[model samples]
Target: RDCARPQPRREVAAAAGVRAAGVRRAERGELRAVAGFFVEEFFLGRTTDPTDRARCFKSLCADQSRDFSRRYGTSDSAMLIAEDADGELIGCVGVNFGRVPAPDESSADGPFALVANLAVARRGRRRGLAKKLMAAAEAFVREDLEEEEAILLVDQKNVPARRLYERLGYKRRWADPDAKALEVVDGSVVAQPVLNLCMRKNVSGSAGALVENLRWQDVALLAAIVAGVAWRDRLAELADPLSRLLDELVTAIPAP
Candidate 1:
């Protein structure tokens, strides 16, 4: 029992009738699934051109795998995958450290970690797996990487993910201008693209102050639409209520 072999610290606690473990480096097979999940979930939606989508998916998969290896293998990146007792990959979280430099020259400044490609299998949702993976990622950044801050970008439409990140102390930093314009074209909002907001949170700072500075009304509106659709069988039945809720939420928060 006193052998010198290094062991991975169990990053997830048992919950909801399941126990989870962190996937260690050199686990190529699991990484492939992680890559595949991103391709299917996020990238797939953005590409309409079949050829472009195919190329993008290929590039993404290869790049992601390489990225994972470079990060985990070299200790420059931190990734935590949650697996059930039966050895099934249920969820994963990844943080790319030092992706951006801090604006201030403070040694207390942490690496600009980009959280991406997080996914929990369909059947594994609501079991607190996502939180566990995120906690592990945060611990790695805070403790192992000695980072004082972490950052991530979530789709403006991903209300659930946004809520989860917020609960975990992630705030919006800045929204993509292009994404804002696209939303307008898609008939989501009439506001100028330049006014789009990005939320950000300093992991070491007060969560309330961080959230108070950003515009999360859009997210709230989107959440209403999602909830309406989930409850009603048709969009028509939910359209008016959803739209009204969006308007109220957006106007509820003044520009800060």
Candidate 2:
């Protein structure tokens, strides 16, 4: 059956292993997590977004998210987030649709769509949340916005994100001849001039395809939940072990 397109968009897809991924619209309350994420990953590091401080995170999310909602023919243009049952904001992505500049005349002056603000929190790393978010965004662009392709930009230094994009069937849509350096706001960049690459995936005729990605964040969240449930009265007894495991799981991910 075709996935029904409606105002409150949410989708779930099956993956290869035990992990299942779902995609859906961002709730009004999740603004903090979404903003904090951008601050932690982009602003804290190096990003081109005009706002460079955590104090500006909420306003930035609102403005960009508002524009995302207002874009013609793309309700999926709004930000999307992935989370665990504990309501943790596991990952997020944003979609945009408008008249994007075409490199060659052959491409139509399009209401082309782009995906931005893609990330999973550092502690929440290794979960395939990024893949699921992109897939759902592409599906919305194809079916709802009636677009054929979804576009995104990746920093050359962000090799991990680049690899995930490639695995999801995104190809080199365009490459900047003169890419700008990756921006690290509250954070530091060891080098200057990080290269930016554009990637794209075809969304035509692809919807309701289930995908799965194992997430350390998911695992950690679930373990914490289960332990809390089984040992509600023994909270103090489990705290030490849980803390140790959490640290181990998080620090193990090779930094990107």
Candidate 3:
């Protein structure tokens, strides 16, 4: 379910300063920009292990594209792009509607649609481009692909992203149990042990529940954990201090 086809529209609109949208074939040239966005902007100065970041992105793209092609066959996966008036690549979001194979132990029926690998360039940050891309992706899934629901994973600490997802009617479906947990230690928290939050949004239901479920304290703590781990990769050293802080905060909360 991977599409390796070249999408000339993406290149043309990206070069022409107009907002371009499509699920056309991805070209080799497009990979350079996509890879660059993840490496230079997304993981810049954050990861201690640069090689690991590179490997992760490569593996993610390969896996996603393969699934895209396998399921759609003649149809390509959707990749929405937003460029500034100058025609530079400002934002990009990829959508895959291919079904994922159920695990051996799972009883889930067929494959599910997933939206992943969303990134917007630094200068393009703050604009409503991400929202537009999300809407388009949802529409594609519901109307075009006829999927009942769409799912995505976000870093537990990415506050802005979490907010965006919540606003878009997505809810925290589950926490990745295998993900490393963050704890406080010393006077300052150390990095390492990151967690990922999984979310799902039904296009047809009320989107308000997602926002109501968000707790500011939880979001802030998660953000801190993500920042610490993403920047320094040391978490155990911060666990003790964080635990104390958590205890204090818990005490401050009015008992039910």
Candidate 4:
């Protein structure tokens, strides 16, 4: 099932010196603004040429436009934005549903609600805008998309981001420690890849995951359970009297 309607706008309290912000799904009219934010925060630093900036901005807008249509059209993904009281775009995050292929071929792969492109403007820093954006993204995944878990990648060098995600209940997942992703640097793809840490959170409240799709970690856990049971039975055989006493105690209990 898919959720076609985007969430309504939600107001978030700002920091003491910062303006209050509102978060919601980006509209078609705000596509340029959304693209501008990415260029300003991520691309501008790479070059000083206005021509390059323009090209980057156009590329980002086109990419985001496709994303926007996919969300409202197919309900499979969304790009969320946070704007200050003045209606200036300050932060953004994206939630997408897809399969993240395991870096190691031997590992398992499954569908997940992926969180990506989380960014906040310099003016919006220290105002908790990132957290608000994150909250909104997770809400879309959980309430709107009916997903149980979400995953994201954070640069290990970004200590603050990592700390923030950990505080939000995201835990480290099994991933290639040396994995790298292609990154845009200087308005172009750089030869070097960015290192990242894989993190995951259960958005569904305390609900056990269905075993329909199992990861290698799940197999390991099941193996541990089996080994534990085998060891317990072996110990019970070595302690026959204790086992018999426990069996007698169980039999002594009256059936309701």
Badly placed stretches (over 4 Å) of model 1 are 1-30, 40-60, 70-72, 98-111, 179-199, 204-256
Winner by TM-score between candidate 2 and candidate 1: 2
The alpha-carbon RMSD values of the candidates against the true structure, listed in the order shown, are 19.1, 19.7, 19.1, 12.9
Candidate 2 Cα misplacement greater than 4 A, ranges:
1-22, 28-33, 45-76, 99-109, 179-182, 185-194, 206-256
- TM-score of candidate 3 on Cα atoms, chains taken together: 0.52
lDDT of 4 by residue, 180-211 (tens): 64445666644454567778888775535334
Cand. 4 Cα-lDDT:
0.72
Estimate candidate 1's alpha-carbon lDDT, on a 0 to 1 scale: 0.61
Clashes of each: 8, 16, 26, 0
For model 3, the superposed segments whose C-alpha errors exceed 4 Å read 1-29, 45-76, 98-110, 180-193, 204-256
**Candidate models: Cα lDDT each:** 0.61, 0.62, 0.60, 0.72
Clashing pairs in 4: none
lDDT of 1 by residue, 38-152 (tens): 5545445544666666666676678667766666545567557776777666677787764433333542234476566677765567777777777677667666666666677
The Cα RMSD of model 1 versus the native structure comes to 19.1
lDDT tens string, model 3, 1-256? 9987775886655434434423233443465455455444554425446565556556544644454344333354565555577556666666665443332344342355777766776645555667866877777777777775888877778888888987776787666545553222322223456567767777643455344444566678889999988767456767889999999999999989
Better of 3 and 4 by lDDT: 4
Residue pairs of candidate 1 with colliding backbone atoms: 171-199, 171-200, 172-199, 172-200, 173-199, 173-200, 174-198, 175-198
- Best TM-score among the predictions, by candidate number: 4
Model number with the top lDDT: 4
True-vs-predicted CA distance for residue 204, candidate 3, Å = 4.5
